[model samples]
Structure formats: C-alpha cells, structure tokens
Target: MRKVLNVIALLLLIMVPLLTACGGTSTDSGTSSPGNDSGTDSSGSDSGTKKHKIGILAPAVTHGWVAAVAYNAEARAKELSNDIDYQIQTSSNAEEMTSQLDDLMTWGAEAIVAFPQWEGMEVPIQKALDAGIKVVNFDIVIDAKGVYRVSGDNEDMGIQGAKYIVDKIGKEGNVVMLEVPTSGSVSELRKKGFVDTMKEIAPDMKIETYATKFTREDGLKDFADILTSTPKIDAVYSMDDETSIGVLQAIDEAGRTDIKVVTGGGGMQEYFKMMPENENIWIESALYSPAMVKDAVDVALKLLNGESVEEVKVIPTTIVDRDNYKDFLDDNSPY
Candidate 1:
C-alpha cells in the first residue's frame, strides 16, 4: 500500500509540472496608451522609439516658392518614413488651415510642423499646446506664445538687402520700399533689418515705405503709382521676386532711368533670368528658399525623440547675384 501511494504522488507531481509549462496565463495585459501610440512626449517623456506620428502643414502652392515648400516637406517626410507615420496638408488661407488643424488633432498626431503662411492661427496653435501636442511653426512666424519656430534669416535678408542697396546706390539715395502686408514678420523682420541697418549706415537716405502684395498684379499697380508719385527714385528695396518683376515693369513703362539698384528677396527663377539681362539695374536677391521647411520637420523630430531643440531656429541668408545666381538655378524646381 505504501509503494502504491508513493507511485501516485510521483505521477501527480510530474503531471502538474507539464500542465503549467504547456499552457499558462499571465495577470498583466502589457503597456498601452488609449488612442495614441506615439503620444505623451511634449513634457519630455521618453518614447520607446517605435513608429511615431508627425503632421506637416503648409500653404497650398500660392506661388512657385510655396509649391517648393510643400514639395520639400514631402521629400523630408519620405526620408524619415522608417521612423514616422506622417500626414502633410496644405491650405490656401487661414480659415482652411484652422479647419485642417482640427482634423490633425482628431487624427492623434504626435507632433506637428506647420508653415502658417497666413495670420489667424493663434487660437489653433495654442489649443494644440494645451492638449500636450508638440507644435512647431515654420517660415511665417506666428504670434502664438509657446510654439517653436524655424525660418530663414528673414532679418539678415533685410540686413543684406539694406547693405547691398546702400553700397550700390551710395550712402544717401532715395530708396523706395515695397512691403507685403500679409507676410507678417516675414515683411516686418526684413523691413526692420533694413531700417535698423540703414539707421547705422545711411541715416540721411530718403526712404519711403509703400503697401503692396506679393502677387505681380499688385506689384505692377502699387509700384506704378509709386513711380508716378515719387520722382528721382534712386533705388528700390523690393522685398519679393514677384513684386520686383512688377516694379521693373512699372519702371520700364514709365521710362524711369534714375533707379540704379533694384533689390529683391526670396529666390525666384524668373528674377534670376532677368539679373543678367538687366545690366543697367543692379538686380540682386537675398536667398530665402522654401526648402527651409525641411529644418522645421527635423526640429519636430528632435522634440518627439526626447532630444533638446531650440524654440527658434534661424537659417542664415545668402545673397544671390548675377555672378552667383547660376548656383541657385534649378530649372526643374518650381521655386
């Protein structure tokens, strides 16, 4: 009886071990975030380095330069495809952009890189911050308090334009200014740089600021009146390529020969072509390419991946002239 009992006990022990090893259940369900897999890094929380969600926003191709912005952003997103789940959206105006921002929030975007080309994004950008989603504004600087910004050296572009215009036309000459109202600080920073630089370099120069749009049509109309009203216009610090083209047309139509140096900003192919042709007019442009949007995306990634990033990232400006314009020429590129 004792031997039989011993055999039964041994069999019971062996069977229990087999059952536990073959089929077992755990009490834990594993870690999970309710809706977002890539969420919760705005406060510098660590991400496990899996597939993250990134949202890219830009203005619809309003012009050649804007088209390049959207294109280069897509290219950069593709370049980081392995690590991120990205959605890029473009808008024609501020209202449309705000609606698009709502859509992005609903889609559970981990981080957003936006080119707020127009004004009136203050609310949406702030809401994004309140929700703990990382926000980075590109190009056109927004007035939103906490959002990060990445843009070309808009101020330096102005500084360079101011210096170039002063150098070519002499310290004291009548310089006409063409300003874009919708461009926000893009126009403001460039204007500020020029104004401040002029104060130091050429305080006595007769300067006049006129309102204009970025479109060639406005440039033509606004500058035509400018030419008519302001006689003896020695130089023009036109802040855009499209604007410069119109200004040139107005100058030619009016048969004005007094203006020697005509300055432009934002590299444009059409304007570059004119540089060599217009030997009489010292045609120059400060390089502010749309491809700088790529830097905004890069900074967003840095923030998402628990890496430190600056609140403002400024890309330095390069002056493009007839002598060096060929280097910036890309016939296939829209901008």
Candidate 2:
C-alpha cells in the first residue's frame, strides 16, 4: 500500500509540471496577453511602447511660422510613431476645424493635441474633453476650464521688450504698440505685460497703440503711414516677426533712423539673421519656437499613460539679440 501511494504522489508531481509546461499563467512581468507585450503596436508587434492614439490639429500654413508649427508637429509625430497612432489635420477656418474635430473622434483618438488658431472653438474643445479625450491646447489658450494649455511666454515677450527699450532709450521716450487683434489671449497677455511693466518702470512714458494684422504687408503699409504721421518715435513694439519684417521694410523705405529700438516675437530665422547686420536700430525678439509643440505630444502621451501633467505648461521666453541669435539659429529650418 505504501509503495502504491508513493508511485501515485510521484505521478501527480510529474502531471503538475506537464500542465504548467503546456499552458499556464506566466511568471514573466508586464505583458498584455500571449502576443501583445508591454509595447505592442497596432499590429500587435512588440516595440517597447504602449499603443495610443493622438490627434494633432493646426491651422493651415498661412505664414512661415504657421508652416513651421505644422512641420514640427508632423516631425515629432513620426518620431513617436512606435508609441503613438497619430493623425494630423490642418484647417483654414473654424468651420473646417469643427468638422475635423468630429472626424478625429470617429477615428478613436484617445487624446488630441490642438493648436486652435481660430476662435469659437471652446465648444468643440470642451466636447472632446467631455468625451474622455485629453486635449492639450497649444499656441493659443482656449477659455475652457479643464483643458491643458501649452504656449510661450507672451507676457515675458512684452516684459523683456519693455525692459530692453527702457534701458536702450531711457524711461521717457514714446513707444509704439503694434497689436494684432486676432491673436486673442496671446495678444492680450503680451499687451498687458508690456503695459504693466512699462508702467512700473516708465510712468511718464506715453504709448500710442495701433491695431495691426500679423502680416508683413500690413506692417509695411500701416507703419509707413505711422512714421509719416507720428514725429519723434523712439521705439516700436511689434509683437510678431512677420509684422516686424514689414515694419523693418517700412522703416528702411522711409530711411528713418530716429527709431532706436524695434522689438518682435516669434522665433523666425529670417528675423534672427537681420539682427546682427542691422546695428543702426536695436532689433530684438522674444523667442517663441513652434518646435515647442513637441511638448504637447509628450504631455498627451503622459496623460494617456495615467501620468500627472501640469494644467498650464507655460514655456518661458528667451530674449534674443544679435549676440545670442546664433544659439537659436537653424539654417535648414523652415521658420
């Protein structure tokens, strides 16, 4: 009886081993299923990155900076292909963007990285957030309560411009404010920072503001009119690179040397190149790279992975001048 019991026990041990060998729960850590690993692509292939769907929305390239925004977003998406199933859509108007927003939802986009250049998008953006999609608003800050915002230091652009102008021409000079009305919150913040900072530093200074579009033609035309009408203009705060280009042209055409300082924003390669050569007028720009859109992609992925992300990712501005423009220069860059 004892020998028979011993034989049965040995047989049971051998059967258990065989059962585990055939098909059993693996002791291996971090696997989705038998085929799908931790980093499984849409094809269920191992690539060391968890699959996620991210959507990119941008305005049609109306200008060089917008073109760069689109380009950088695409480049970054391809760079993160192993981890992301990305769809990028560009729109020329708000209506087109509304339709594209719905299309993205239909495509099962779990996350969206949007640069809503046009206004009245608060509804669609909120709808996306309500649908359990994580929206990372880039470039322009929407008025939605919970959506994440990623943008440059527009206010600092104003602040830096103020400080530099004050230091260059003393606190008592007349300053021109070239404002883009369509810039929405970006323009508002920058205008506020400029006004507030200048008030703090130069209370006696007078600021003459004129509405302008973010185009070189407008800058050239409007500022040429401005130079003729307004006498003794010490500085001009043109908050856009394209517009500054036009303003510079206007100044050059008029051959005005009294304008001591011209301040602009948007990290344009062309404008940076103009900085060193033009020593007659102090030209400076507050750095705001369209390449910073890559951070929105990273933020979306982090949120999809259940990682914590900041509510407002305010990218700081770098004050660029002739001495430091070389650091930000990219010869092959589209912008």
Give the candidate number with the greatest TM-score: 2
lDDT of each: 0.85, 0.87
Q: Which TM-score value belongs to model 1? A: 0.83
Find the 10 residues in a row with the least total lDDT in model 2.
Answer: 28-37
lDDT value, candidate 1, whole model = 0.85
* Model 1: CA > 4 A from native: 1-49
Candidate 1 displacement at residue 80 in angstroms: 1.4
TM-scores for every predicted model: 0.83, 0.86
Model 2 C-alpha lDDT per residue in residues 275-313, reported as the tens digit of each score:
988888888989899899989888998999999989889
Worst 10-residue stretch by lDDT in candidate 1?
A: 27-36
- Model 2, runs deviating above 4 Å: 1-50
Error of 1 at 85 (Å): 1.6
